[model samples]
Target: MKHIFIVSLALLSLCAVAQQKPNNEVSLDALTTETQFSSDSPDLVEFIWWIPNEFWEASFSQDPSISASEAQEIVSLVEDYTIVIALKGKIGVFGGINYEDVDHIQKEFTVTYNGTDLRLIGEKELNADTRNFISMMKPMISNMLGPMGENMNFFIYDNKKSPINVFEEGYIQFTLGDYETGTELPLGSLLQEKQCSVTKKLHNGKWSYCPYHGVPLTNK
Candidate 1:
C-alpha cells in the first residue's frame, strides 16, 4: 500500500509540472497573421511582412520527425531578421496599386527596433560566402511563403552586428515613404492576445472582437 501511494504521488507531481509548462504548440497562422499588415485603399494595396524569429521557430517546429541536425539548421535560419514586400497587379491602373508606388516605398523603406535603424543585409554589408548562403536559402523560404512568395521581394537585416531582443523592447516601427499604413507596431501586445477559436488566428490588434466569429477576443 505504501509503495503504491508513493508511485501515485510521483505521477501526480509530474502531471502538475506538465500542466504548468507553457506549451505553445507552434501556431503558424497565428504568428504570420499577427505580424502581417496591409494597406488597402482605393489607390494603394500592398503587404508589409515583418518576419520575426518566432515566425521561423514556428515554421520549423511544425515537423515533429525532424532530426537533431535538422533542428540546428532551422535554428541557423532565424539568425537574421527578414522582411518580405509584395506588390500585386500592373502599374498605373485606375483605383488600383501601381508598380511605382511600391517601388518608391521600397526605395524609402526603413525599419527600426528600439529606436535603432537595423542595417540592411546585402552584398556590400555581408561577405561573399554569407551572401551566397542567403541566396541558397531563398528557394526554401520562397516555398514556405506559399503563393504570395512568387512576387515577394526579400529584405534581410543584420541582426548579428546589433542583436535585437525584440521581447526586451517589444517595439518595432516601419516607415515606407508617405504610406499611411506605415506606423509603429506593438509586438509585445500581440504576443499576449488569444487566438480566435474559429479562425485559429489572431486578429490585427485593432479588433476587440474577432471579425469572422463576432466573439470577444481574450488574452492568454
Candidate 2:
C-alpha cells in the first residue's frame, strides 16, 4: 500500500509539471486587438509588437535604466508586435500579427515627441514617388500639431481620404512640430495621451524618417 501511494504521488507531480506553461514565449494571436476611441473620425486599427526591454536595449545598443534579466522576464508577459489602424466614426482597431509576416511589409514611419517637439519620420518604397504626397501632407501635419503648449494632441487622418502607397524603394520624412527649447522635458519622454504617428516597412528592413527639421532625411 505504501509503495502504491508513493507511485501515485510521483505521477501527480509529474502531471502538474507537464501542465505548467513557460513564461517568456508569446503567441502572435494573443497580441492583436481592435480598439474604439471617441472621436469624429473613423475607427482606427492598431497592431502591437512587444519586445523585451533587454532585447530592445540590445538591438538598439542603448542601455536603459532596467536590468536585462528583468526586461526579458517582463517582455514574456506582453506580445512582441503592435499594429493599429483607424476605422469609421472615431473608432479604431488594433492587434498583433505574425512576427514573420509583420517584419516583411515594406513601409515605415517614425514619430518622436519630446514634450515640446514632435517629429514625424516616414519611409516608403523607392518605386513610388512620394514627393507630391509629402508636399500635400505638410498642411495636414501642421494641423495635427494644433497649438503646442503643456499637453499636445496627435491625430491620424482618414486613410481612405488620403491613401498612402508603398513602393519598391522607400523614402523617409521626419517632421518636428512646434517645440520650446529651454523646457524641462527630456528626450524620449512618453506622452500621457494617445499620441498620433504613422509607420510602415517591408520585410525586416529599416524604416526611414525625416530629421527634426521636417525635411526628409534621405535628402540630407
Candidate 3:
C-alpha cells in the first residue's frame, strides 16, 4: 500500500504539469509484456496493460486548484492517449472507441442532500429542496480533497450517436462495476474470466456470427 501511494502521488505531481499534447500516438504494440498470465480456467493475463503515469505527464498537466473548465478542456483533447484529473482531484484515463464525444462525463460525482446520487446512469430528478441541499454541500465536499488514483477508469460509447451516453438503450454494464469509476476492480480481470462466446443471429433463417471475446469472426 505504501509503495502504491508513493507511486501514485509522484504520478499526480508529474501529470499535473502543463505541456503540449504529443503529436505522436502512444502505441499499443509497444506496451510492456511483463504481465503474468493467469494459471486458472481461462488464460487471462494477471496484470493489466495499464496506462503508465508517464503518458499522462507527457500529455498535459493541471494543478489540483485549476478551474473545472480548464480541467475539462485539458481532458477534451484526444491524444493517442491521455489521463484526466477531476476538480475534486480524482484521475481517470478517458479514451477508447468513444474518443471524440466527451460530454457524458461528469467529473464530480454529485449527490443531493436527500441522498439522491445523480452520478447515476439513468434519469434522476431532484426536487427544489434536494437541489438546494446539493448547492450547500458542494463547498464542504470540495475542501476534503484526496486524489483518486491516476488512470483507473474508462468510458465506452456508441459510434452511432451524435454524442453517446451509457444511459441510452442497449448499454451493457460490467456486472461488477459499482462505483463512479465504474468497476470496483480493474475490468481486465473480469474480461479474462469471461467465457468467450460467439453471438449467433438467425436473420430470416440465415446464420451469421458475432463474437464478444475478441475471437475471430470466422471459425473453421
Q: Top lDDT: which candidate number? A: 1
> What alpha-carbon RMSD in Å does predicted model 3 have with respect to the real structure?
22.1
User: Where does the lowest 10-residue lDDT sum fall in candidate 3?
Assistant: 183-192
The candidate with the higher TM-score, 1 or 2, is 1
The candidates, ranked best first by lDDT, are: 1, 3, 2
lDDT of 2: 0.26
lDDT of 2 by residue, 39-110 (tens): 222332222221112222233223356566765544433222211221111122453221212222212322
lDDT, candidate 1, equals: 0.57
Clashing pairs in 3: none
Name the best candidate (by TM-score): 1
Off by over 4 Å in 1: 1-24, 82-105, 124-148, 180-220
TM-score (all chains, Cα) for each model = 0.60, 0.17, 0.18
Q: Give the runs in model 2 whose Cα sits over 4 Å from its true position.
A: 1-63, 80-220
What does candidate 3's lDDT look like per residue over 158-211, in tens digits?
Answer: 122232221122221111112222211121211111222355321110111223
Pairs that collide in candidate 1 are: none
Give Cα-based local distance difference scores for all models.
Answer: 0.57, 0.26, 0.27
User: How big is the positional error of residue 57 in model 1, measured in Å on the Cα after superposition?
Assistant: 1.7
RMSD of each: 9.9, 23.7, 22.1
Judge candidate 1 at residue 76 and give its lDDT.
73
